[model samples]
Target: MARDIADDGVIDGLRAAATADFETARAMPPEVYTSDRFLALESEHIFSKEWYCVGRSSALPAPGDYLTCDLAGQPIMVIRDNDGNLRAQSNVCLHRMSTLLQGRGNAGRIVCPYHAWTYNLDGSLRGAPAMSRNSGFCKDSYRLPQVRCEEWLGWAFVSLNPDAQPVASRLGALEQMIAGYDMTRYSEAFFEEHVWDTNWKVLAENFMESYHLPVCHAGTIGGLSKLDEMICPPGHDAFNYHTILKDESLRIACAHPSNDRLSGDDRRMTYLIAIYPSLLITLTPGYFWYLSLLPKGPGQVHIRFGGGMSDDFKGDADAAENFRQLKALLDDVNIEDRGCTEKVFRGLSSPLAQAGHLSHLERPNYDFARYLLDRIETGQGAV
Candidate 1:
């Protein structure tokens, strides 16, 4: 039998500790980072219910191109079918439970390696060798079960819950705020997946705030930001955002130098947003990068991260050299962040661990904690 999450008093205690005021709110307790029961509850209530970016639409541009991943314990595949439609389907073979796809590529048809059953790119059954011998076997009745998929701002997002709200409806005014970036034209430039040895929320919180920049990223991008310039304005029910104001102090050309149409702040600022449960994005005038996390356990997080450049950068003659330099800097930043969060995870397991007070700089993280409390305790939906 599986352990019960409802029986744990820790959930109630976490609800009580969460507060609206960032200055007074305590950080989420240690058990939420170490308990398997809490992780299971999160998978059902949060991961399966939220609209998350799987990757950019540019990745699988042609028909039959696909990407496969395990989401909230569901083996699923996303493909661009011959009909020029992006679709998500259960990766499980119709005949048995054998997974139909491995790593991503263009497949003429999804063929089950376990048996001879085959499925079309649109998820219809194409063939089942030797199965016609069975009486009453109807091939039309068995097609890959379809999952909900939607596209937004050049990215493809998937949700296991049929009743979940569309990603655009939930984003509210975020589109308007970021309209000048024109994210629809962005293409995949770099992509990689890795498992980090830290709690998923721990990494999510890192991306949600700029408080650690001075110490964690000092010699890199941090030096360009000022403590007073950071702002944590009120967030919507579906997302939280803050700005990292940059000055001319930047040592490297991490962002595009300019875009004539973008407003002044849009060219100079980097906006970091956490869209409930697990999608995190860093948007700037020239380029963008995103991190979408999947919790394997309380201690392991699977991360899919990639970045793309806007037309301003892509159109540059030196774009290739610029991307190489940008990726090197990004690789260094990721190394620094990974080290810091893994250390924090280890600290959470200490006997004396406690939910410390939050800082004004950590307001976005406070919003994230509130989102978690609302979903798990009050049943407040992720707008």
Candidate 2:
């Protein structure tokens, strides 16, 4: 006899199961989305333990080039040293723990403005003005604490914990899927960020669902993928890593306006993949965009969208026009989706809310949530 998926009991909540089954469902519990205590647990358990993508490596192309960004509430500096090697270190000065750099720049060395402690671009302590001669003060012992850093598909990933698995090892087959693509052939054209109020997991769940595209993104993604065609399978396979939502009709309408574009292979399509924990990569024929999610608190997250282009897209006049159109379309889609998610965050605060379910179509997202819950529950977190 065949097994009933309902009998598996993979889901363990009333509202959770209900919400996953219905399209117009209530939001998750208020505490899970709005509690500071829960947010701190996310910082300790999930953010600290997993490999998180901060920004693209293209943001720092030259030696001594650096970008200061936060890692799970802790400030960090990702730099390319004089030797062209990338390194991650705490962005706080060792003296009084002051923030070293506020943003991105090219620097000869990292200097503390407070007490003037200077460190090499590689994070090695080189000088401590006025304090090198202090008793028992050894420059060797004062180097900045380093964090694990790695680059994949031209993006930079950082971890706050020293014992976290190497980024590559944790990615497993994901690394190979992206490796096949010529990632270095692209460069950023524009970048922008905005903050949303919600649990980081909520945003992850939202991304995994395509059911809302028709209604929420009518002006953009709705113009392309229909509901049935956007159905995605569950797995950590290549498609999951580099999946494409093809719609040749839309592509032709945007590309060769003079030609009556119909259903075909060269028509419009959207490809989106996640570099697990915090990076979303999307591509169309004309443009490529990466969205990085930074959790600021239980109810707050920063989302950045950066666009890039391949030589093929850059040189072709037709492709450039299509790219611009797609960019505008994507911007609209993102704004609409964010509005929906933000509204859900507010609704999550209702007193009657509870946990939700996982639909077969939403199994990937459910697995992701469970994976995060396991990590946070078992990790060194606030009890």
Candidate 3:
């Protein structure tokens, strides 16, 4: 059984250790944001332990359906057997730890090329091609080790820890908050990833603040938000999650003539939600975008972006085209953001760089730093 995350003392200690005062600085301590050891701690405690969005349930639409992914250095396979239940298992073959699958595909059973060890689509040992009877190995008892798996809002999440809490409990209020919108009805139209030469924290902190708009992202997002009304939301002050509203200028630009679903309140604002650890969900009138920051090393991170159209627009040709256009615009925003991130990473390591102050409107960045440090310092989410 997975441990109860809600009552875990470690999580409580993490929340309590947050330093409200430390967040006022220009940046986190040099080691906290740049050390290799610190980065590894996060991988173990944060990425490996938590429920990470690995793919969409739609990716495995039938029995014998499976997808392979490497998350936090662990190779995992997610499958929905013929009966339609989802299961996650180590992609490593029990026989020699060799990877069972290379990528996504349909397979009635996974067989290890090295040893002929085979596992059913549900991850049970189905056979061992040539093991002699005297070898004394029981196929029925040697099934692939199963990992915890769950689905929320069409996204499939898997936890390396076999005893982690259910996806619903870990997600808390996020489901209800987005319940009115159905993500399962949508389809992925765009996927792209790039290496960011900075600590994962740097990128996450950047997303939490709108202050960079007038400068860093000025060419792309600045004109869309009013310089003054772009203040950070107060929601970051608590353990509370945040979603930002897009200004009217950007809202109008995102809604194309092909998209009829952009009318009403949905067209009025852009929504940004920061899920703890490393998941970011952004909702626009025409589509929803998810960004996952997977740490590659001390000063490098893999950023993957997934874009999907609104459920209502999935079948409409014109609406789909508008969503594709929206994705292109988002890609532009990502490029603009990455350009600034590269420069910032260089500065963080320079002797000339000193800690800076937080503007009133950039308080969300403060909250993020505070939470990150708390998790690191206490070893609660240490990799």
- Runs in model 2 deviating more than 4 A are 1-30, 176-181, 237-244, 249-269, 318-322, 354-360, 380-383
Q: Name the Cα RMSD for model 2.
A: 7.0
Candidate 2 local lDDT, residue 270? 51
| RMSD to truth, every model | 2.8, 7.0, 6.2
Query: Candidate 2, overall lDDT?
Result: 0.65
Q: Of models 1 and 3, which has the larger lDDT?
A: 1
- lDDT order of candidates, best first? 1, 3, 2
Report clashes for each candidate as comma-separated counts: 0, 9, 11
lDDT of 3 at 317: 54
Q: Write the per-residue lDDT of candidate 3 for residues 39-97, one digit (tens) a residue.
A: 66677767777777765677678887887777779898989987889989889998878
lDDT of 2 by residue, 1-383 (tens): 11112311322222253334334333334455566665666677767767777677888889988877787778999999888889999999988998997777888988888888899987888888787467988888888889889986677888877787676566666655444334565678777777887656677667766666678778676656666555455545212432445565555222233323223433344555665676777654435777788787666788877875554455566766766776776688778878888877766666655555444455456445545445554664324
Candidate 2 minimal-lDDT segment of 10 residues? 1-10
Give the deviation of candidate 1 from the true structure as CA RMSD.
2.8
lDDT of each: 0.81, 0.65, 0.68
Residue 228 lDDT (model 3)? 63
Candidate 3 structure, TM-score to reference? 0.83
Which predicted model would earn the best lDDT? 1
